[model samples]
Target: MLTRTRMLAVLLSGLCWTQGAWAQGSPTGPAVVATIKPLQFIAQAILDGEGSVSALIEGSDSPHHFNLSPNDRLRIEQADVLLWIDPKFEVYLAALFADTAASESSLMVTASAISGLTLHRYPDGELDPHLWLSQGNALLIAQALTEQLACIYPDKAPHFRAGLDQFRSGIDKQAQALQRRFSNQHVADYLVYHDAYRYFEHDYGLTHSASLVADPDIQPGMREVLELRETISASSPACILLEPDASPALVNTMVQNDAVKRITIDLLGNSLESSANAYRQLIDHVATGFLSCLNI
Candidate 1:
């Protein structure tokens, strides 16, 4: 059974595709607009030399807290095919999609709208939207975006599909490389400041013992903190993970203990545009972070 959030996502995605089915625009050239940087990168890579693709959020900033700059608004208005993740994570995107539903030059693809988009929650019921952290899920996302682009711009369908095939193949090779690289190291269990990266950990058979269910927002009382301390003491995990902006308390715990390794992993490309500009590099960074902790 789908949860209410998922059900709403399904309804919104239906509306997204239904608008296209009913009204196919006759634009000559393709100018795709993506909501996030990673989505933009994948679309551009697929339409390499075939179309014009760009992103509204090109900064190494959190899309969850993204404010539309003047350039962002301009790009959104000019985009022909807009690809984005679930708007539940981005309020501006949700409102923008609602307003542009009647427009002919706009299309939005949400990651939560597709199959194989795994939804996870903490034991307390908070959602994790960081699906792009895992290489496997990233491949699925890339495939969906490529297919949608091909469908919308059939004039370049052949070119798009060929590029997609190559990209997917390359991604597969990278996945294999990740697996082989970490197979013997066996850094299965690591502590995270936030409850993200299940997809990446699951793909690599690693265990994510997250310190917080929700990042930056996690409010653990004294009891929870004490319990977490015990868990860390027992596990003695090879590394403790922290994000630059997440949980100061949890990170301080590790620093105080001096019992585990410390690794800073960034979900938003290290809060920089270059390191996390693509899916493959993001996955690589995660895998490398894990292996680096194991002293592998």
Candidate 2:
């Protein structure tokens, strides 16, 4: 599969750029590329450069449901380093990297390989691969990327290490700030309109039982709806966290129960928040949103 990606390198670097930028390969330093926006954002934060880091995934698109285009294949091939979450979410990426591991030597980093990660299994018992939500896991991710970047660009080891240390310290500060602000809140559990918070829950010691949809891309069935209603009634979650793309009807049903209120959980930057500042900013937003609603 990676061989095919390598073969397909004849396409374009997966980053959405002017046709001119895609045509121009790296002039200097390692060309760090990632499969998703969050990974790309983290890499950019730690590894400062002018077009040195690139993202293969587009904004506002879910990596779980991604289909590799010709451009995506090329981006993998051209990348000196490719960082991604576990193969579970981007299953195709594993096969791509595995096939070309010998030839490409892309110096890939797998986000889930880090120790102390908590599992969020589906009914079928598979690893939920959205590790970016947890502050601790994001730290682990930054550290791993820093180490990998050192290996790839040994000349930049000092710079990369310093940046990484700063990144780690920044993560700690944000976590502490959130702890200080939210310490009084005993938010043991909440109900998500979907299953995107396992990593967040694991990191902050929060428990979340989501109102399961029959399929991530589809609606919940009657039985699933009834079960969720029961969960909401019994749990009395502070608010029902609803993603922008999630079904409004499901949220409405739960909120109308009088046991829960509807709260917007902005997963992506919309008309409200802009492009995104740092990895920690996303975590801060999560903490702020939950705290604001829960404290209410």
Candidate 3:
């Protein structure tokens, strides 16, 4: 027969061993990293607490000119899954992903290449990578994310599927609400600082009369400015949609008429906190901005 102290020690050892085994067997999901906040928002919805999601480009930084730092590189290297729009838009990430060594260990998702998404092109024939603006495209993205994540962590496939369903339902509800809101009001013609809202506008049946510039980095010249001003004066558009970072002076130059309203549309979700519903909030906020200006 064992002594009381010996029996107690043996029981404690067995308990510790069992705990260790359980810990080792527990399923811990992947660490996903997105190239931008909008992508991160979509990923967060699908991940839905099954894993971690983070954005590489935060705040007002434009991916067009974003350069990765040592920390950023480390984050990408350590991530189990990486998400980005495409090489054309996120030009900085193209070369990094091209390296076989860099891409070998992780799942890299080029959202633009995902099938079932309705993609668009710029007037210059370049692919428009802002597909997330459309709730439909967002659904497709969520589905793709679910499938990719499921492949990596099959044990959490059910949770990911549930997340995708929830995301689709949330988008459908929000889109219906927005459609009702727009149907009850008159949305007048508008102009945008750049042609970035094509997906949003197409989804809502709203069209801009003109744009100040094709690319935000390239400011309109004197002739282009005069033409835009003439167009604004002639058509009397209800509003001029300026981005959060648009130049006030340029806007003033383009819109000398005080009757033309100016509304700041943040497509980047700059002011939003990171959450599962952030993508929906972004769409709602954008619609609200348009309604505030276009309703006259």
Candidate 4:
């Protein structure tokens, strides 16, 4: 079976070929490129009828360690506006940005740059780059991308602004509802396969007891595994969250004989079709996972 990433690559390649042929004789808006699916989804929302958006890395691969191909690099160079979370999250993109002449076209929306965000830092004092996990950050993403699109196609500023306002309204209601849903639940502590939900947790006032891996690409050492095992055994958390893109074997090995319930959460919206409401659906999907796991 072709993975989603490969499938998207083939589809986008075909589309690019078709679009390239058409562009030879027609005037078109600048191409928008994003580093991942979530960013692509947000960009798509703002660009709707104005232009198309493409993602460099697709499928289940973690952005933390993705290796860009020649085509991917070409997309970046050709993009009129490039959006990514930050180099801390997509570490490989940092060098790519520096090496390529596309620096002037790229925007890094880190937590610090965005106002009204509750940022977190790792023990090493590095900022958490998972800003998209929080609803507030999602709003920030939509606003930032709207500004980019407006600049690129100033004639469509009204369209972009209207879309941004609609998105803001929809997400505001959903965020309030999600907060109510999680707040009503009594399960304050839970376990996760990866430490990717701290932003969400912080936003919702949920507490994570332990994580199987701090970095998705790095497996837990034996000592760390034992510690997590002990923590789970001691707390017997009501729910253990796993990333849909991660290996189920890792979650199984961690849980072993524990009676805890397991739930899969997809933060990247990989399974969702890109649209204006894709981010909202992604948030709802994650909320459903938490609600199902907590039985609230």
- Candidate 1: segments with Cα more than 4 A from true spot: 1-28, 58-60, 124-127, 247-250, 270-277
TM-score of each: 0.80, 0.79, 0.88, 0.83
> Scored by CA lDDT, what does every candidate get?
0.65, 0.64, 0.78, 0.70
lDDT of 3: 0.78
Better of 2 and 3 by TM-score: 3
lDDT of 1 by residue, 1-296 (tens): 22335334633443334344314544546777776666665676677766577766644566767787777777777666667777766667787765554463465567766677676666767556776766556666667766666556656668877877877887889888878876776454667877676777777777766564355654777787777777777776767777667666656753356757788777666443432236567666777777877676
What are the per-residue Cα lDDT tens digits for candidate 4 across 178-229? 8788776577467887777778878788777888888787787888877777
Question: Candidates 1 and 2: which is better by lDDT?
Answer: 1
Over 73-123, each residue of candidate 2 has an lDDT whose tens digit, in order, gives: 876777766787767767767778765443544655666665565556767
By summed lDDT, the worst window of 10 consecutive residues in model 1 runs over 14-23
Model 2 gets an lDDT of 0.64
* Residue pairs in candidate 1 whose N, alpha carbon or C atoms collide under 3 angstroms: 188-207
The per-prediction CA RMSD against the true structure, in angstroms, equals: 4.7, 6.9, 12.1, 8.6
Question: Candidate 3, residue 141: CA error in Å?
Answer: 0.7
Show pairs that collide, candidate 2: none
